[model samples]
Target: MDTTLQDPLVGRLLDGRYRVDARVAVGGMATVYRAVDTRLDRVLALKVMHPDLATDAAFVERFMREAKSVARLAHPNVVGVFDQGADGAYVYLAMEYVAGCTLRDVLRERGALPPRAAFDVLEPVLAALGAAHRAGFVHRDMKPENVLIGDDGRVKVADFGLVRAVGSATDTTGAVLGTVSYLAPEQIEHGTADTRADVYACGVVLYEMLTGAKPHSGDTPAQVLYRHLNTDVPAPSAVVPGLPAELDELVACATARDPEARPYDAVALLALAREARAALSEEQLDAVPPQARAQVRSGAEDRTSVIPRVLPLPVEHTSRLPAPPDPGPAPGRGPVTVHRRTAFLVVAAVLLSLGLGTGVWYINSGQFTRVPAVLGQTEAQATQRLADAGLDVGTTERAYSDVYERGTVMAVDPAPGERIRGNGTVTLTLSRGPRIVKVPNLKGTPLEEAKKALAAEGLAPGVITYAFSRSVAQGAVIGSDPEPGTERSPDSAVALQVSRGAPIEVPDLTGESVPDATATLQEAGLKVVVAAERIHSPEDAGTVAAQSLAEGSRAAKGDTITLTVSKGPRMVAVPDVVGMKTDEARGELEAAGFRVKVEKTFPFLGDTVTGQSVEGGTNAPEGSAVTITIKGL
Candidate 1:
């Protein structure tokens, strides 16, 4: 059944931009959907917070903050965040959609993977987490389900909704945020998460990939949490025999109960993992334990042949028996007598044929010899090793490799120790050293295009710092470290400096307080410099009245903005404009900075000032209003 057809969100447009196409997966806090950005005409994954969780303002804010943080990461191995917004009760984050299965799916279908396959997935996952850790973000929840293996064989870390800055306080009052099976001891106990917490989770994932089961399992989540806090993760070899000791050490170092004992961060753990891989021999690396479902399937013939036979089949007799009629003929002649010697010979002959057939089958197909380990060895060395094992070299191939040296054996057919006929041949694949490429000149290229260029050259985009440059266009690359034309190893990160464009328009700050004006200017990428001298003005004291640069004028980033603060209004004496014609009094008072009013008696009208609110010589604040009273006489 197509369950996605029943989802209400399916076929609905979210925020009028993302057209939700299909429900991808549901989690405790959100439901992820495969959606297309109608406006941008691109596909992306939309993670909508569950309506219940969206109601919590704190949770929603944290979720959106996660979107912003992950968006800043910009790592190739990390899923990118495109946009974040809400449509009524649905708060969604549009993310880069990876069209492939999760690591969880691989484990479920294949059980324990071969060491090579396991490392192939783990390395990229670690790289992604390492980038996050270096950028001061921690993926609090790391699990097999969050590791996305794309159809193009790219591994990306997804679902960073629980990501938080390193050393940030976690919610200790309520339920923990991560899956219990992959939780670190510190996370389970105090609800504190750091880079080490993610390291621990990655170790657990690695263990699962090696053993086809989680390192710790319990009947309930609480039980699992308890175990995480009290018990240490067992070695993978404990469950899957023949696993290399180096892998055991790597898992142990990462899954240590004490966060202090584990690697400080994902990058440190990644280095350790690489070191372990380098130290392992091809035999150790390719060893397939009995627990591996793939190995079991590959050895199916051996298992099937080992089944014991319950009973032997009877041999067919060509000659028809003389039957009971021979009994009557026995009296007449010896012809009715059974030929016991002939019957015994016939039975022996049939048994001999069966024995010969069994011998031939064992020699041709059942008998086997183990393939010799020859990885990392030179072609000549590998050939000699195979010859020692009574095997011949069949085909020699060459391929580029970053890990293996040139002319060294990178891999072998049938792996290192799989069983094969004694006369079988092994194919050797030799390495051609690391792939190197010259960094292209990305100056003046758009930031996005520059990133793509780096990726095309097998390089990764590193920290991006922005600066104001008149020569370089806005949102374009200013330059890069290591310069252009420099050769670098594949997947090396190159630091980039992007242009923030021409100076920004400085907003007018008149009538705003010093702090408010300073903040407003800072937001526009301008620095504030308050003038020490105070000036009398109509504006309130401490308010900005004048600026060094005119309003609506452009100023470069970090440009100083001088602001003149206002003092209280100046005091001025009121002018007496009474007992004179209204026009004369108004003109005379206005000349002296005072207003005039007319007054008249009851039965007659007169254009003359009568009374004033303030005394003639009394001082009043400048720009303050003065009232004049008029009477009819």
Candidate 2:
């Protein structure tokens, strides 16, 4: 059925910008579609949150967060997010459209892949993840389905909807969000995840690619989850026999039950994968195991096996003779006369030819040869050994090792005793010694620069925490996990404590009373200093008029928060109106910013002014009252 036609979103324009054309894929959280940007006229993938999920505020936030998070990452192998918006019920993110199948598709068709092919796919995946991990984001859901293998062979990691900042608490409230097959043990047990979880998923992916099957499987998701938490992931070699030991070790390192035993991040795992690839011989990398689906016939013997066999036909001979001569002879003598040796010889020759052809086919194409053992040998020595055995070195790579000396071979592909063609190539992995590194002192270094320094020293910048520092500047490193002078493996994460300068946020004290504002500022780790002289202002008397630091501005502990108090409105002088007309006095007093009230001493009196309050011409508070007594007739 063409489900895309039934989908309402198909053929509709989303946000009036993206013209959704056809549905590409559907996932638990959202449905992906092929769309064109009407404004930009570029093809892209539109990931629209499911209507049900969109109604949930938390899910919508997480969906939009995926867009924002992926957009910040500018790596080539990471899928790009161009825009995020909503059109009616459809909230969608327009992402870069990769036109090809997924790693899962390849596995479904080909079963297990050769080591080289598996590495080819896995290395790019790890590269994309390494970028995300370094950027301090974890791809909480990493599976073959999220790995997009473009038609042009470019690999991209997608679907960061579950991504969260490192050190975030796990959600034990509900079922985990990732596929059961790829979920890390911690993710299954505690619902917690970190960069190492992604590493574990990639390791499981690598295992799947090498063996053409998952490490653990069950009838239900719960059972699978239980296995992830309880069982150790068996090595790929266990299923695909003859897989390189380095591969087993790589899988073991990645899928370790304990998160701490795994690589700190994808970048570290990538290094190990490259090292494993280097140690394998070409024959080992391309070796076709029994578990792989037989898709193509590689040799002439396979071609011959498909040809129809020619069956021998039943033979009958009729002998014609002069009628009476044979009648007198015995019946046994008559049959002996008809025997033809020439015909029998021809039949025998054809059968002999068929037998010889089958033998030639087997000798020319069906013969197998064993890969010579070449462990612990130099690259030149390994190459010469393979050449003496009619094989060639395919690829050479260096890997860190504690047992093998530097420049000597550490491992070989086909496991030193696997069967391969004589003309095949052997990949040699040379030793680079142990990967030991010291934690560099990053104290006093800027946070961003400290991260770069750690990366340069073959270390990863782990979780960042902030603290108030008296001597160190803000955004500078206060210390690190494992501290300085500690020796650790390469790509180990070093947690950094960065100085937050001083713990202070200036309080908004515009209208607060002097006492209240002072207490608030003091409580916020600041010293309050009130100016001695009061300033005249419109604000209420004794309220704060101004502050040294602006509202919400950052400040250091014990930093003084200078304040200017308000003394209320300025006072105005009252005008003198003694012996003046009552109306004139009232007008003069009112004009001098004082309210006037008349006090008549006699009824029906003349409009002459009488005694006035405050003796007139005296200063009183602004907007104060003045009283004057008028004389009667």
Candidate 3:
């Protein structure tokens, strides 16, 4: 049965973002889990602090702050930190997920390494540490378990939990924060660590790699700590008889009991390692120690070289042989006595033939070949460069990378510095550039929902702005600046416009006098504009007749309202029509655009108009009413 099935956090979604899949490892401080970043659509290792430590607010704060600084320290060999947060009882860090085993796994599988293989692993580890040291961080916990070897053969340094700034107090609650086996003497005695402490641990690791065993053995961790504090790490040559002097000197220099005697930092040690490698010959570089274990093969070994595969020399070269017991040949053959001159000629001829053959072989296959470094180079450049070195370009693959530019080589197979056949094909993995995502249409979405939507799409919510939108509800997104469907790099900030509900309201003001309307509009925090020309209207003179903006229109504060003044009424000469019939008068009056009314003088009989209030044919205001009397008695 899988033990992870019983782990409480195995199936939990942490911080509403990381979906934990399975527990990867459990340490004293935290439990690491293989998880998916649901928001970013990527896989990441989620290291959740143990519940006991999560309760410490100061520790949690320091952990997150350190994580933020580590996130900014971006190097190819350092595992990347993408995010950090807390949820309920879980405080976690989301890191780049490396798909391979740790150096501890490698050491357990392949006992001791030949010099070439040991150097191959050591160089990258030192490079990573050198970078961290220069950047003012000391990885106090340097152990095989913290060195990650990816399936692609890349070496990455991980778990910066115990890492701290150069001069900070190097202990928590007065307890050392490192594995007992790899802690330096200073770390054990004085509770302080610096770049030199990392160097000492690395020296111990180097000794283990070259000798297949630690210098000191103990029944318990207490014994191990006692040994680290009391004794010095032994030279590899002491354990492995044929190990080279150069490596022994390196281990001795790095593991000096006094911090002042060790290399100042990993950078200085890396320089020394390179110099030591340069001084050794090919035979010494590949010398296999007697204690090095032959890995039992169930199947073909993994070819990628984070921890390299060391090939051993022939048995005759590695093992000692004894002289024959019976020195004399058959008695008859000895008495025969072969000619010395002929034997000499034959030996000389054979030597000459061997020399010529070696020359021919050297010409045919020039020399040793290694995969050339083509990282961050364009495909064309990498191909041409590989061709120049007599190596062929193999299959090319593409992967997204934030560190390398698009179309540039991101990784190589038979990776950089690994030996290869003269004509071996080097596989290239190119960068496809940072992942691009389309901004989602967030119009009409609630502010919180829109932010969540952006995060889900691998984008960050940028500055927020509030605007009045008649069509969009309050607290809902009015629109985005990039609009919608624009392509953007992941984590790009997107600005949002949220609705502040409908704008200011404007009331009707058409029939009010100019001064009165101006005051009304001003009281409403609106500006007023009066028309230059007055127009004849039903409203009295100097009163507002029309407004520029229509009634019920939406406007904001400080908006302008235009008013047109009325010119009272217009008049013209009246024409006599006293004798005209009431129907005729009515027809004429109606035709003239005047409303007409009739009044009967007596008992209502005649249709004739005997009198008119405004004499017939008079021009009144265009839409005014006129009255007429009928003679009837």
lDDT-based ranking, best first? 3, 2, 1
Q: What is the C-alpha lDDT profile of model 1 across 26-94, one tens digit per residue? A: 766678887667555456789888898788888778777878877889888999998899999999988
Better of 2 and 3 by lDDT: 3
Tell me the spans in candidate 2 whose CA falls farther than 4 Å from its real position. 161-178, 295-633
How well does model 2 score by local distance difference test?
Answer: 0.77
Clashes found in each candidate (C-alpha, N, C closer than 3 A): 6, 8, 0
What are the runs in model 1 whose C-alpha is more than 4 Å off? 161-178, 295-633
Residue pairs that clash (backbone atoms under 3 angstroms), model 3? none
Task: For residues 489-559, write the lDDT of model 2, one tens digit per residue.
Answer: 88899999999786677768976898899888878777888999888765679998788899888887667
How far off is residue 123 in model 3, in Å? 0.9
Residue 264 CA displacement from its true place in model 2, Å: 0.5
Root-mean-square deviation per candidate = 22.8, 25.5, 21.3
Evaluate candidate 3 by giving its C-alpha RMSD to the native, one decimal.
21.3
Clashes of 2: 8
Model 3 stretches astray by more than 4 angstroms: 1-3, 161-178, 297-633
